[model samples]
Structure formats: C-alpha cells, structure tokens
Target: MKFGGLQLLLAIALALAAGVLGAIAAGELRDTGQSQTLHHFVHEELDLTDRQKAQLNQLENNFAAERKDMEISLRAANSQLAAAMEDEHEYGPKVVSAIDEVHDRMGDLQKATVRHVFDMRALLDPQQQLRFDRQVASSLTSEPGE
Candidate 1:
C-alpha cells in the first residue's frame, strides 16, 4: 500500500505489543531461564486460567478472521488508488474518490485494532487490567525500542 503512514502505525502497534509481551516474558523467565513466546508470556503474565485462555484464543482467532477480510478490502482500495494515481493523462474525480476510499479503509483498520485491544483487555482481572492498560499506554507514548 502507498499509505506508508498507516503501515507504520500498524507496525508500531504490533511492535508495542511484542515489546510489552517480551518484557512480561522476561520477568517470568527469571526462575526457569527458558525463552518464552508471546503466547506463553501472555498466559503467564496475565495469570490466565484455562477458561480465560480458551476465551482469549477464540477472541484472537475471531479478530484475525475479521482483520483478514478487512485487509483484503483495504488492499483492493489501495490498488485502485495506486492505479488512479499512475494514470499519467488525467487526475480526475476517480483519484479523489480512491483517496477517500483508502483513507476510509485506514480508519476502519485503526478502529478494528483499537476495538480488538479493548476486547482483549476486558478479559483481564482488575490487577491484570491495570497492567494491560499501563502496557498499552506506555507503548503508545514511548518510541519504538525505548
């Protein structure tokens, strides 16, 4: 996609998630000294019970499906936008419309990501919820790799 800004935003979001998960995993590894994947980190750090793990797994899977569909639509919109921009002869209303479509897709993706985060956070207990909130806040406010 030509929307480098949008791509960067998404990358940052994923990076933040990874960094936070890694940090949590690091703390958990003090006793065992074994490396932890993000999935294991989440379970250990969040103190997720079996039921919660199943629920979170289901939720993640559901969001992944929805996100895949959204991505396909967004990709189509971006392709149209790129084609319109590449039409050397004329810059018409089609270009404007394509730009709008791309922006709309970006907005939709952003909304979906935020909603997914909130949905996941809702599964946590009071203490874990606070930790989740802090992780998100810190990630959003701080630069990548900070």
Candidate 2:
C-alpha cells in the first residue's frame, strides 16, 4: 500500500487546501463569536448612561480604525507566507520567517484588541464592570456556540 508519486502529490495538495480552508473558517467563527459577545454585553446587558454610551462610541470608533489597520497588516503577512510557501516548496527559512511575521502581526492585533476591551471597561461603573468582567471571562473560556 505504497502511494505513487502523483497520488502522493494529490494527497499533499488536498491536505494543504483543507488546512487553509479550516484556518479561514475558524477565524471567521471566532470573529463572529467575539463580536457577538462584545455587542451583547456592551449594548444590551449593561445599563449604560448617555455619557458612557458616548465615550464607548468614541472608543469603538478608534478601535475600529486600529483594527482595520492591523487586519490589513495581517493580510499582508499572510500573503508573504503564501509566497514563501510557493517559492520554497518546503519548510525553509523564508517560510519560517513568514510564519513568524504572521504570528507577530496576529499578536499585535490581539494585544490591541485586549487593550481596547480594557479601555471600554474603564468607562463602566462598578456594577457594569462586574457584568462586563464576567462576560469577558465567559467569552474567553467558553466553547464555541456556548
């Protein structure tokens, strides 16, 4: 039960495609879940004052712009990874560097997002903060679709 060269190549291609598609799908699902968690907690669960609402709106606008920039950089890093994978055709130095670059970009985005969440938390009153904290913890710990 040895694979021929063409069959091996086809299997490798299918595996790579599956990996890429899974990553994309997982990212989308995570994004959607995070968005819903934040939206429900901030907009519906908490009783926000007008002033707090205004401040949160400003924070959201600023974070939105920053997130967009980070997402663009992440996409560029992903492109570099793809190019490296294509050119190297193996787990080589360029591919390693590209993977590191992508990870760094992703870390940057995650850090910024966490900071933004804290910034929003800072505006909440004590009671609201309690709920917010719980929501954040739940979102972080819960399984998907929970």
> Of the candidates shown, which would achieve the greatest TM-score relative to the real structure?
2
Q: What does candidate 2's lDDT look like per residue over 34-59, in tens digits?
A: 44767667988798999999999999
TM-score of each: 0.68, 0.79
lDDT of 1 at 133: 78
Model 1 misplacement above 4 A: 1-41, 88-92
Q: Relative to the true structure, how large is the alpha-carbon lDDT of every model?
A: 0.64, 0.74
In model 1, residue pairs whose N, Cα or C atoms come closer than 3 Å (at least 3 residues apart or on different chains), thus clashing, are none
lDDT of 2 at 14: 42
Residue pairs with clashing backbones, model 2:
none
User: How much does candidate 1 score in TM-score?
Assistant: 0.68
